[model samples]
Target: MTHEDVWRAIERFATEHGMSCSGLAKCSGLDPTTFNKSKRWSKEGQPRWPSTNSISKILSSTGASIQDFTKFIEPHGTERQ
Candidate 1:
Protein backbone atom coordinates (compact mmCIF):
# COMPACT_ATOMS: atom_id res chain seq x y z
CA MET A 1 0.00 0.00 0.00
CA THR A 2 1.05 3.58 -0.48
CA HIS A 3 2.60 5.37 2.51
CA GLU A 4 -0.26 7.82 2.75
CA ASP A 5 -2.72 4.94 2.65
CA VAL A 6 -0.83 3.18 5.40
CA TRP A 7 -0.83 6.27 7.59
CA ARG A 8 -4.51 6.79 7.02
CA ALA A 9 -5.19 3.22 8.02
CA ILE A 10 -3.12 3.51 11.12
CA GLU A 11 -4.84 6.73 12.07
CA ARG A 12 -8.24 5.17 11.54
CA PHE A 13 -7.32 2.05 13.47
CA ALA A 14 -6.04 4.12 16.35
CA THR A 15 -9.23 6.12 16.41
CA GLU A 16 -11.42 3.04 16.31
CA HIS A 17 -9.47 1.60 19.20
CA GLY A 18 -10.12 4.78 21.21
CA MET A 19 -6.44 5.59 21.30
CA SER A 20 -4.63 8.71 20.28
CA CYS A 21 -1.37 8.51 18.35
CA SER A 22 0.58 8.96 21.57
CA GLY A 23 -1.58 6.39 23.32
CA LEU A 24 -0.89 3.89 20.57
CA ALA A 25 2.79 4.57 20.82
CA LYS A 26 2.70 4.11 24.59
CA CYS A 27 0.76 0.89 24.24
CA SER A 28 3.31 -0.28 21.70
CA GLY A 29 6.19 0.53 24.06
CA LEU A 30 7.41 3.25 21.75
CA ASP A 31 8.02 6.92 22.40
CA PRO A 32 4.87 9.00 22.58
CA THR A 33 5.75 10.58 19.26
CA THR A 34 6.30 7.31 17.45
CA PHE A 35 3.01 7.60 15.62
CA ASN A 36 2.93 11.35 15.48
CA LYS A 37 2.25 13.04 12.18
CA SER A 38 5.47 14.97 12.50
CA LYS A 39 7.43 11.75 12.80
CA ARG A 40 5.61 10.33 9.80
CA TRP A 41 7.27 13.03 7.73
CA SER A 42 10.99 12.97 7.33
CA LYS A 43 13.43 15.83 6.95
CA GLU A 44 13.48 15.18 3.20
CA GLY A 45 9.69 15.26 3.09
CA GLN A 46 9.42 11.49 2.74
CA PRO A 47 7.32 9.20 4.85
CA ARG A 48 9.11 7.31 7.56
CA TRP A 49 8.38 3.64 7.29
CA PRO A 50 7.31 1.87 10.45
CA SER A 51 9.33 -1.11 11.62
CA THR A 52 7.84 -4.58 11.88
CA ASN A 53 8.51 -4.71 15.60
CA SER A 54 6.54 -1.56 16.19
CA ILE A 55 3.66 -2.83 14.09
CA SER A 56 3.68 -6.06 16.05
CA LYS A 57 3.62 -4.19 19.32
CA ILE A 58 0.76 -2.04 18.10
CA LEU A 59 -1.21 -5.11 17.06
CA SER A 60 -0.56 -6.73 20.40
CA SER A 61 -1.63 -3.67 22.31
CA THR A 62 -4.84 -3.41 20.32
CA GLY A 63 -5.56 -7.11 20.73
CA ALA A 64 -5.68 -7.34 16.97
CA SER A 65 -4.22 -10.05 14.79
CA ILE A 66 -1.92 -9.50 11.87
CA GLN A 67 -4.72 -10.35 9.49
CA ASP A 68 -6.86 -7.61 11.01
CA PHE A 69 -4.08 -5.11 10.65
CA THR A 70 -3.50 -6.27 7.11
CA LYS A 71 -7.11 -5.53 6.34
CA PHE A 72 -6.55 -2.01 7.63
CA ILE A 73 -3.43 -1.70 5.57
CA GLU A 74 -5.20 -2.99 2.52
CA PRO A 75 -8.89 -2.73 3.03
CA HIS A 76 -11.22 -5.22 1.27
CA GLY A 77 -12.52 -3.17 -1.65
CA THR A 78 -9.20 -1.43 -2.08
CA GLU A 79 -7.31 -4.59 -2.79
CA ARG A 80 -6.30 -5.50 -6.33
CA GLN A 81 -7.30 -8.79 -7.87
Candidate 2:
Protein backbone atom coordinates (compact mmCIF):
# COMPACT_ATOMS: atom_id res chain seq x y z
CA MET A 1 0.00 0.00 0.00
CA THR A 2 1.01 3.55 -0.51
CA HIS A 3 2.38 5.56 2.44
CA GLU A 4 -0.73 7.69 2.38
CA ASP A 5 -2.90 4.61 2.59
CA VAL A 6 -1.23 3.44 5.75
CA TRP A 7 -1.76 6.77 7.45
CA ARG A 8 -5.38 6.84 6.28
CA ALA A 9 -5.92 3.40 7.70
CA ILE A 10 -4.54 4.51 11.02
CA GLU A 11 -6.81 7.53 10.91
CA ARG A 12 -9.82 5.35 10.07
CA PHE A 13 -8.99 2.94 12.82
CA ALA A 14 -8.74 5.71 15.36
CA THR A 15 -12.05 7.17 14.22
CA GLU A 16 -13.75 3.80 14.41
CA HIS A 17 -12.57 3.49 17.99
CA GLY A 18 -14.21 6.82 18.79
CA MET A 19 -10.97 8.65 19.19
CA SER A 20 -8.92 11.16 17.31
CA CYS A 21 -5.42 10.22 16.20
CA SER A 22 -3.97 12.20 19.08
CA GLY A 23 -6.18 10.32 21.49
CA LEU A 24 -5.10 7.06 20.00
CA ALA A 25 -1.50 8.01 20.40
CA LYS A 26 -2.02 9.02 23.98
CA CYS A 27 -3.85 5.79 24.69
CA SER A 28 -0.91 3.95 23.29
CA GLY A 29 1.41 5.80 25.67
CA LEU A 30 2.96 7.68 22.81
CA ASP A 31 3.39 11.37 22.25
CA PRO A 32 0.03 13.04 21.66
CA THR A 33 1.15 14.29 18.30
CA THR A 34 2.63 11.04 17.12
CA PHE A 35 -0.11 10.55 14.56
CA ASN A 36 -0.81 14.16 13.86
CA LYS A 37 -1.49 15.04 10.22
CA SER A 38 1.38 17.50 10.30
CA LYS A 39 3.76 14.66 10.94
CA ARG A 40 2.57 12.70 7.92
CA TRP A 41 4.64 14.69 5.50
CA SER A 42 8.14 16.02 5.41
CA LYS A 43 9.09 19.53 4.37
CA GLU A 44 10.39 18.08 1.09
CA GLY A 45 6.99 16.61 0.29
CA GLN A 46 7.98 13.01 0.98
CA PRO A 47 5.64 10.87 3.03
CA ARG A 48 6.84 10.04 6.49
CA TRP A 49 6.34 6.41 7.32
CA PRO A 50 5.36 5.44 10.80
CA SER A 51 7.91 3.27 12.49
CA THR A 52 7.04 -0.40 12.87
CA ASN A 53 7.17 -0.07 16.64
CA SER A 54 4.59 2.69 16.52
CA ILE A 55 2.33 0.58 14.35
CA SER A 56 2.62 -2.28 16.77
CA LYS A 57 1.77 -0.06 19.71
CA ILE A 58 -1.24 1.34 17.86
CA LEU A 59 -2.53 -2.12 17.03
CA SER A 60 -2.01 -3.31 20.58
CA SER A 61 -3.67 -0.26 22.05
CA THR A 62 -6.66 -0.56 19.71
CA GLY A 63 -6.91 -4.35 20.05
CA ALA A 64 -6.62 -4.64 16.28
CA SER A 65 -4.66 -7.20 14.37
CA ILE A 66 -2.17 -6.82 11.57
CA GLN A 67 -4.76 -8.28 9.24
CA ASP A 68 -7.15 -5.49 10.07
CA PHE A 69 -4.58 -2.86 9.20
CA THR A 70 -3.50 -4.70 6.06
CA LYS A 71 -7.05 -4.65 4.79
CA PHE A 72 -6.70 -0.93 4.32
CA ILE A 73 -3.84 -1.58 1.95
CA GLU A 74 -5.87 -3.82 -0.36
CA PRO A 75 -8.36 -1.16 -1.44
CA HIS A 76 -5.57 0.93 -2.88
CA GLY A 77 -3.50 -1.93 -4.24
CA THR A 78 0.08 -2.64 -3.20
CA GLU A 79 2.51 0.17 -3.78
CA ARG A 80 6.08 -0.22 -4.92
CA GLN A 81 7.91 1.47 -2.10
Candidate 3:
Protein backbone atom coordinates (compact mmCIF):
# COMPACT_ATOMS: atom_id res chain seq x y z
CA MET A 1 0.00 0.00 0.00
CA THR A 2 1.03 3.58 -0.47
CA HIS A 3 1.82 5.94 2.37
CA GLU A 4 -1.37 7.82 1.56
CA ASP A 5 -3.33 4.60 1.59
CA VAL A 6 -2.11 3.60 5.00
CA TRP A 7 -2.81 7.00 6.48
CA ARG A 8 -6.24 6.99 4.92
CA ALA A 9 -6.90 3.62 6.50
CA ILE A 10 -5.83 4.86 9.88
CA GLU A 11 -8.18 7.82 9.49
CA ARG A 12 -11.04 5.58 8.39
CA PHE A 13 -10.35 3.15 11.23
CA ALA A 14 -10.48 5.95 13.75
CA THR A 15 -13.72 7.27 12.28
CA GLU A 16 -15.21 3.79 12.28
CA HIS A 17 -14.49 3.52 16.00
CA GLY A 18 -15.99 6.94 16.75
CA MET A 19 -12.63 8.39 17.55
CA SER A 20 -10.43 11.06 16.11
CA CYS A 21 -6.86 10.15 15.12
CA SER A 22 -5.63 11.78 18.28
CA GLY A 23 -8.08 9.81 20.37
CA LEU A 24 -7.10 6.57 18.67
CA ALA A 25 -3.43 7.19 19.29
CA LYS A 26 -4.04 8.02 22.92
CA CYS A 27 -6.25 5.01 23.38
CA SER A 28 -3.57 2.84 21.86
CA GLY A 29 -1.03 4.15 24.40
CA LEU A 30 0.75 6.45 22.02
CA ASP A 31 1.29 10.15 22.26
CA PRO A 32 -1.86 12.01 21.24
CA THR A 33 0.03 13.62 18.38
CA THR A 34 1.18 10.32 16.95
CA PHE A 35 -1.42 10.29 14.20
CA ASN A 36 -1.75 13.96 13.65
CA LYS A 37 -1.58 14.91 9.99
CA SER A 38 1.45 16.97 10.84
CA LYS A 39 3.17 13.93 12.24
CA ARG A 40 2.54 11.97 9.07
CA TRP A 41 5.32 13.86 7.33
CA SER A 42 8.79 15.08 8.19
CA LYS A 43 10.15 18.61 8.02
CA GLU A 44 11.69 17.71 4.67
CA GLY A 45 8.27 16.51 3.39
CA GLN A 46 9.06 12.83 3.36
CA PRO A 47 6.27 10.43 4.19
CA ARG A 48 6.38 9.21 7.77
CA TRP A 49 4.57 5.97 8.10
CA PRO A 50 3.08 4.65 11.25
CA SER A 51 5.21 2.13 13.08
CA THR A 52 4.31 -1.56 13.27
CA ASN A 53 4.37 -1.19 17.04
CA SER A 54 1.86 1.64 16.77
CA ILE A 55 -0.39 -0.43 14.56
CA SER A 56 -0.12 -3.38 16.92
CA LYS A 57 -1.07 -1.30 19.91
CA ILE A 58 -4.12 0.10 18.13
CA LEU A 59 -5.27 -3.33 17.01
CA SER A 60 -4.70 -4.84 20.42
CA SER A 61 -6.47 -2.04 22.22
CA THR A 62 -9.41 -2.14 19.82
CA GLY A 63 -9.56 -5.91 19.49
CA ALA A 64 -9.21 -5.60 15.76
CA SER A 65 -7.42 -8.10 13.56
CA ILE A 66 -4.78 -7.28 10.99
CA GLN A 67 -7.30 -8.38 8.39
CA ASP A 68 -9.67 -5.76 9.69
CA PHE A 69 -7.06 -3.08 9.31
CA THR A 70 -6.10 -4.27 5.85
CA LYS A 71 -9.61 -3.80 4.60
CA PHE A 72 -9.24 -0.10 5.13
CA ILE A 73 -6.26 -0.02 2.82
CA GLU A 74 -7.48 0.96 -0.61
CA PRO A 75 -6.49 -1.37 -3.42
CA HIS A 76 -5.22 1.45 -5.58
CA GLY A 77 -1.64 0.24 -5.96
CA THR A 78 0.10 -2.86 -7.25
CA GLU A 79 2.22 -3.42 -4.16
CA ARG A 80 1.60 -6.49 -2.02
CA GLN A 81 2.97 -7.80 1.23
Query: What local distance difference test score does each model get?
Result: 0.80, 0.85, 0.91
Tell me the lDDT of model 3 at 66.
97
Q: List model 2 lDDT by residue over 1-81, tens digit each.
A: 677788878887887788999999999999999998999999999889999999899889988999987765645655434
What's the lDDT for candidate 1? 0.80
List, residue by residue over 25-76, the lDDT tens digit for candidate 3.
9999999999999989999999999999999999998999999998899856
Candidate numbers sorted by TM-score from highest down: 3, 2, 1
Question: Against the hidden reference, what TM-scores do the models get?
Answer: 0.82, 0.83, 0.90
The worst-scoring run of ten residues by lDDT in candidate 3 lies at: 72-81
What shift in Å separates residue 65 of candidate 1 from its native position after superposition? 0.5
Give candidate 2 regions above 4 Å deviation: 74-81
lDDT at residue 2 of model 3 (Cα atoms)? 85
Pairs that clash in candidate 3: none
lDDT of 1 by residue, 30-76 (tens): 99888888888889998798788888899998899887776667643
